[model samples]
Target: MNIRKMADSGNDFLAETDSPLGLGESGKPIPSSPRVLSILSSVFERSIQKNEKLLKKLKTKDNVTVFHGSRAPTMGIGQYIDRISKYTCCGTPCLVVAYIYIERYLQKMDAYLTSLNVHRLLITSIMVAAKFNDAGCHNNTFFARVGGVSTKEMNRMEIEFLSNLDFRLHVTADIFRAHCLQLQKEGFGENPINHRPSNKTRAKCLPQIAGYTCRAV
Candidate 1:
């Protein structure tokens, strides 16, 4: 998106989230208003689900089998992201970085996101993002419980995910903002990618994670 240039165009701008605690392992404080995490989660989740279904459709004639080893979670993607945010104490920027990692993973794996892999992918990406972007973070064992996977499995997935992305963990601030704007555009109200929690609903549900701020681009 050449997000750096877009930032210069003045369609949108970045403002640091209120950081009473100051920046530390979590990078800047999460902005206190934008629903970027929820939007991105919805968008990414729907894209993966749709593409997985499409691939299966094409394979039906050939009798090519697809295995869905894990079931989809009861919590929606937005809610799931909220849980990750709260449990990991990752800044909102981590959500943006995690989205970037997921895109890279899909491109590299030549695979669609699916019920079997999405939760694992989401958790691993966020954990990796936090380690790379946040100054400090919890260990894999902690994230394992948060993500409903064993610590060993979470560790394995983290390695595999990093290798998939060629260990490129740096994401510029402009790119991070660009991802947020993209999610807002793509996954905002009634766009049909998936249902998104409204700002009001999210506010009540995610008091801590709701601090991220954004304006229209």
Candidate 2:
């Protein structure tokens, strides 16, 4: 399907959650409503959990074989990262930074402007990340294909998602990248890829490194 058709489908699907039109009619913050907030929270939590699981699976010792078994021949995370890296001239580190940024942002928001569409949110986040880190990141069709949405739909979803976010696009995790680089220079090495760190260790170490970097910056 084309972008316009996909966008239309998204609009219809989102309408079931709540209309943005209701914002003006009710004169209340759209996301403040309990129902919408609940839905957004649920969606965000589930998406984060799934992302974490996927990351863990990918970082496992047997990841190469397992990833091949779990994904289509052409669409495994490794293949995806490899393709992106060739264009970006950066390794999976850039993608990890972007994912971390998206997750942190979602966690901070008390609610979404509309019911959060987790799938679209994830794809959009990845697109934004690619644009930030890759010099050659321009493929709406690829994003749509990977996201199982249409380019038009993805664009519309991005706009709506940003609107709900009040147009504030903060790439908070960029600082973390600098810190991670420094740590690696100081001998942290490429262990994050080769060795599976516990989620808690990953989470804790990232923030601490980011904090140090921020002070240095």
Q: What is candidate 1's lDDT per residue for 1-217, written digit by digit as tens?
A: 2222222332342323222211223433443223455466668678877877897888832111121233555666676676776666665455666778888877876777765566667888888877765455778877777776666777777887888789987766566557656755674464442233234422222333332211111
Q: Residue-pair clashes per candidate, as listed?
A: 10, 1
Give the distance in Å from residue 145's predicted Cα in candidate 1 to where it truly belongs: 1.5
Looking at model 1, residue 146 earns an lDDT score of 76
Model 2 Cα lDDT, one tens digit per residue, 16-107: 12432112233321211222222333434554466556656777322121001222222333333333333323223334344444555455
- TM-score, every prediction: 0.68, 0.37
Q: Which stretches of candidate 1 lie over 4 Å from their true place?
A: 1-27, 31-34, 60-68, 187-217
**Cα distance off (Å), candidate 1, residue 34:** 6.5
Whole-model lDDT for model 2 versus the true structure? 0.37
Model 1 residue 10 CA deviation in Å:
10
Mark the 10 consecutive residues where model 2 has the least summed lDDT: 208-217
TM-score of 1: 0.68
